[model samples]
Target: MDGTSSPGLARSLFLLLVVLLSSSVAFIEPCDLLYDQAVQAFYKGDYGGVVRSMEGALHSYAQVRRSKVGCRLRCEDQHPFDDDDAAAAAVAELRFFDVVLRRSACMNGCIEDKLGTQSMHRVSEDVVQDFHRRIPYNYLQLAYQKLKQPDKAAAAAHTYFQANPEHVEMGQNLEQYKDLQGVQEDHFVDREARPHQHSFSAGVRLYDQGDYEGAIVLFEEALEEYYKADVECRALCQGPQRFEGHNHLLYRYSLHELISVFRCTSLGFLENLVKRERCLSRKRWGCPSQTASEASGMDMFGRPFHLHGRLCREAGGFVVKAAWYLRRHKQELELLLIGSATMGVEFSEGQYWSSTGGREDSNRIPSGTDGWMEYVPISEKKNVSVMSPPQLREGGPLVYDSVRLVQNSIALNGTQRVLLDAVISEEECSDLKHLAHTVTMAGDGYRGKMSPHTPNERFEGATVLKTLQYGYEGRVPLRSARLFYDVSERARRIIESYFLLNSTLHFSYTHLVCRTAITGQQDHRNDLSHPIHADNCLLDPEANECWKEPPAYTYRDYSALLYLNGDFEGGEFIFTEMDAKTVTASVKPKCGRMVGFSSGGENPHGVKAVTGGQRCAVALWFTLNPLFRELERLQADEVIQALDSQAQSQWDHGLHINPKDEL
Candidate 1:
């Protein structure tokens, strides 16, 4: 009985142990076991294990595929699949990617059954057609096969021919298919893989295909070849001007066409002349045509002239020529001035004819806190200096070649007058005499030639009006733009000293000249040889103290007209003012002497028309500046602050500023 009882206990114990192990196994899951085992084998250099584990995962996946379908799958924390179904498809697709990625022919049919009727190539094609455009040739070849396009398959195989030229075997196989037309196309494509050539013929082909722009590029290449030859053959004695001229002309024309083609380019095109320098070489390297260079030195209407700078106490008393580089493309330069700059408040308040603070109907607008347009009434005290006549010698007309600013002055009113006198010197006098001769020669030569606008009678375009009218007044429009020069240092020094003496005085300044002959009959309707206008009218009446209040009055600033030589006949400084009705003031031409007064509508002044020979004079004007550069600096600061705040906000949001931001 005891032995039988012990046997029953043992059976029960054994059964209990089996039940416990079975429960543990059920909880662990066969898939989990396979996963762990496969991971371990994979790391131990058992690629077969990796395949087996991956297969086990798929097998487990298949068992409960319905439950896992359309569920998001994560790698780290990124969701590669947009949908659960996409996740499953990606898993299956990855296996095919892996096989083709390795370029393994060994695994050819391993996935055939699993892939079923959906070919691996079809899967690859779908991926590439959607988002994976950078597909491999091996995968693409397989895709062509599944598409049953033998010609495309052969074309794909031929892609590898460069590295593996022995692909003739594959090509022959593809030829067995009846798409002979496709095969022929592939052959033709292969032939075009030769080295390319750059020439006129090549460019002509491109041009014939409606590619004029491309043709231009080819022409440029041919031009470059010529340039290289010219460089190689450059002689030491010969100047490089010829070659440079050719190059500049070609480049200029090409750039012009390109600008028209795109219909857009930066201000760089206009500023090219400023940045480029003339270089000498047999090759037309940094070159320009003689005609173009000569043209640049002339005024807008193709008349020779020189740029000058001026300044005055009254408004419009000063007018400086725009920078030489900037003068050519005034429209573009104006855009820069208008778009970004904050103009003085007074400018917007009045029309072109009225001064900023003038009590005219056109300038009665009220001042605003912000905006480009605003009206600032001029204070009575501001016009105190305008009434006094500048003590300047009304000497013979003198001309100068160059001028530049140096140190400013800080003196009383009398001292300021003395400072202006200190600017003149013997050297300046001699320069005037030489300039007079040069002008005479140039005028003689120009007059001899058939004058383009000979009978300057009609009011044609602005060009015609300015050339004929202004020319008759003995005033030459500017030619090349003027820059800073040490020769005019004395004059600039005097102006600077005046400014220092009166910190309240702020204005722009420039120096100019009237050259050679004058054609009075052709300049204006009146028989008068010279016409003059006051310069003071540009100022606001309320702001200027020179003008009388209540009924309103006009003010005249300082203008210094110095005679360089006394070799001419009818050149005289004429001042026209409506003091006692209309008054005409005239001064004879004399070397070393200068006539000083106001200009424009404020004091209408002109040169008595040149009756004979040549006339040379150094003309300078000064104008007022209300707010000055200080205001400009303040505005710049405000713009910077706004930009900073915007930058901080972008930083907090973890985003970078756009490249296009106004950096």
Candidate 2:
């Protein structure tokens, strides 16, 4: 009987302990757990997760506050509260509301920073309320404006101004919104079908199809349409408002696209010239019929010419006597011959003579030349039907010779720096620009000053835009990524061979950056130039500077910049030797040129203000420590495979790869 009683006592004691533990665990409310999750998500840069978790917390808290039963079950406060239960509940509600508002503000900022205004609108609409509105309305106003909903933006701005009547900036913003609302309405009503827009779109399609000549014509048409639009706007609109009414933004964008198309077309022609020259050199086509000319000329209309030239191939130089027959239209034929004769022989080593109103020395040619001499036609438009004397041609190879890599030492004190010319091919340079432009179009233009909260004073008057990085998470565009990786690898090899840098050192990242000049506006004044600084530094926000003290580990040991285009003004890379108190060297941005140097105290450099056009470049940073080795190893194969897959997909889709809708 005593043993049975002991067993029952033990069972009851164990059951009591279990119930106590369960009650303690139940005291931890769902809202608290949700808030913790939201905080974690915010730190991880997962704005969407932050929004979801915060919304859940808000809903849970609201449910607990609305129902007494729910409050009793969930709100098991660990701290003791006196008889003033109503005040405690009020305090708790206010605290929870405060947390939600702060989280929502952060989420709104994230959306605005990354996804632009449309996303900001979606996120703002969810959080903004009449009772709890303060900062959210400001974001709502801006978001609506970007969405082209002027009326809604105006309404948001008005509400914000009414809430904070004494706020000077808010009042100013309200007035601006009101003014823009009228302009926006007028634009919507007055805007008509623009011919240029149609032409531009058609041209882009033709370009995608590789019909460059057709694309050029359409682009020209688009430019003419823009001019017509401007003229019409000037005639119709009042003084100072003529330019304001027309689509100037579209006009500027069209110009940019036209430039890109022209570049592509020019590159295509150059490539074809190289290919034809290569075939000729290889004797792919049987030795030129011993005919006067190696290759015959065709007119713009694709009509073959009765043109011939004597081939005088030489080791160092060659001289050819090119002759053409004039038909009924002698004037046109002579003019065409004069213009096109030099096109093939312009790159020759020695000067050649043309028979268009030029005296030929008797010593250079025999006394009685031949039937070719009798064919020389006079400048008059009459039809003589005579064949002209052969034009003397002396020039180097028809195609561009291989670029020789040349390195020059920069005269900077205390640093070993060099500029490498012909480091990359023209094709690679063009490819990089196209990739940068694509990425810029896809993302929010370009980012400046890393953080929005950071003061712009340090940036001077420059605006910099950066594309997705490579050799990390495969964020770079597929084609551009391959080009960048190739360039980076070449740079690494150059550093190893020329500078004698350790082969073990590896590049951490490669990215494209475009820098443009800025005009002073408001309190901010920025020059296109970047301030002198070393890449390896500890960011010290207290002093508003990059502290240049050496760290224990080697990071950013070297920097490499590959200039993509040289068609810009004023921006120059300058290296300052602090010890010598002199500018060591100033390098102009040249296409396919690469510059590399130590990114330490010995080499302090800055970009001079770009006064006119924008400058684009590829920046590569390397480090001795293998901190990013595993990341690069993991991403290398994935990136290559993804790029191959993308290329195959593009091929399958045929010409005219549609612009990505995600960006």
TM-score of each: 0.25, 0.33
**Candidate 1 global CA lDDT score:** 0.34
What TM-score would you give candidate 2 relative to the actual structure? 0.33
**Candidate 1 lDDT by residue in tens digits, 1-663:** 111122123323433433343322211123434544554565575645544553454344333221111111111012222243445776757754653434322222222222222231221112222121112233334445555565555544444322222223333443343344545542312211211122433544565576655654554443333222222122111111211122323332332233232222222321221121111110122233232224235456333332111211110110011122234335433443453344322221112112211123332221111111111223322344357854433222223333322211212111122112324455656654443333323222121222212222111111111222232234442121111122233343344343332433222333334343435543343323344434554323333312322111122234455566668766666554434124354567665455444343345555555655655555444434442222212222233333357569888776655868857
TM-score of 1: 0.25
lDDT of 2 by residue, 1-663 (tens): 111122123323333432343332222235545655665666676655665665565554433322322112122221223344446888866666665455445434432332244221221111223213333345445555655767656555554443333333444555565456254432211011256545654555666676755655555455444434433332222111111122323332233233232222112212222222222323422334433232444354323333232221310011011111112123433443443353321111112222211113321221111111111122221222124622221111212234334444534333556676777788888877776655543112112233122222122111011222332234555456566656666776665455564346576555566655443421333543565666775333344434332221126777778788999767788876543235678889898777777665557677766665667887777776664442332244334555578679989888655679536
RMSD of each: 40.7, 37.5
The candidate that achieves the highest lDDT relative to the unseen native structure: 2
